[model samples]
Target: MDENSHPLVKAALIHAQFESIHPFSDGNGRLGRILIVLYFVQSKLISQPIFFVSEELERERLRYYDLLNGVRGDQPDWSSWVLFFLTACHRMADKISTKLDAADKLAMDGLRRCQTESEKKVWVYTFSDPHTTVKKVSTQLKIAPSTARSALNALATKGLLYSDKQTKRNKKYVNYDLLGVLT
Candidate 1:
């Protein structure tokens, strides 16, 4: 924090150090990854620790290991490791921001087409989990099971949700639009 370094670069250095030290036997790797987000939050680069880098790290796990190991090897390749870390951060931020924008637009569009408060609540809840059942929705929103089913049906009619299977009991509704946004 005292050095005049960029927050991302500083975070990368801290993460590399933690992983190299192998501070704990059980959760050092997980805690080191979480520290990246905590650093960003504390540095005021982000208001919340919501940004994620773990997925990208997991995808490039082999290369990630090599990079971390490189720093501890005979020839310390700090530059390459820092570059990889920054690239992962950039890619994740862009992907998450795009999905958030799409989800916001879908929420607005769904709300505009909703007819009742229950429908709106169900629609919003669907964004949290696009695949839901009437029982789950009813219990979560404190509405009757019949009312929840009606809301699900109404959303299905509006092309916002569809039945997952042709079953008589324990039916599931899926919100394709929200799913698309998420994926």
Candidate 2:
């Protein structure tokens, strides 16, 4: 494809071709799905394969299938498939942007309640993996287990995390706020 061709249109063609070929019996669907992101990446449309349209496509599975088939019909009309693909891309990009904005706001709010450097580190880490154990945090932050536990406990007290049980034997902390932002 040339640079003059719209990237979304190129992505649509690539996805349709991959699906029609059905080169791999087991993973044809998976490969065609991955091709959407690959096309964007290779075209420099996005820095990384972060815009995910699979969720949108899966939600409209019947329409998606019909559009793909429409592109392969005797008349060979690609308008429907291209429109669907572009629409999905636009919706998914907006969704991702909204989620990231919410996450940033939540992170900033949580950071304001942190009093210590250790607590701040733990807070930052939670933005990536909202569900974590003290042992994992300790390893990731290279802090003593006791210090990590203290930090986790502090966050819990500040409403950043929750621990159902107060036992020290085997306790897990969940960053409900971050999880909420993500979901």
42-156, model 2: which lDDT tens digit per residue? 8898898777688888879999998888878578778778889889888988998899999898888888999999999999998777888899999998999999999999999
lDDT of 1 by residue, 62-155 (tens): 9999999999967899999999999999999999999999999989999999999989999999987788999999998899999999999999
TM-score of 2: 0.85
Candidates' TM-scores? 0.73, 0.85
Report lDDT per candidate: 0.90, 0.86
Worst 10 residues of 1 by lDDT: 160-169
Candidate 2 residue spans exceeding 4 A from truth? 1-6, 24-27, 41-49
- Tell me the lDDT of model 2 at 95: 93
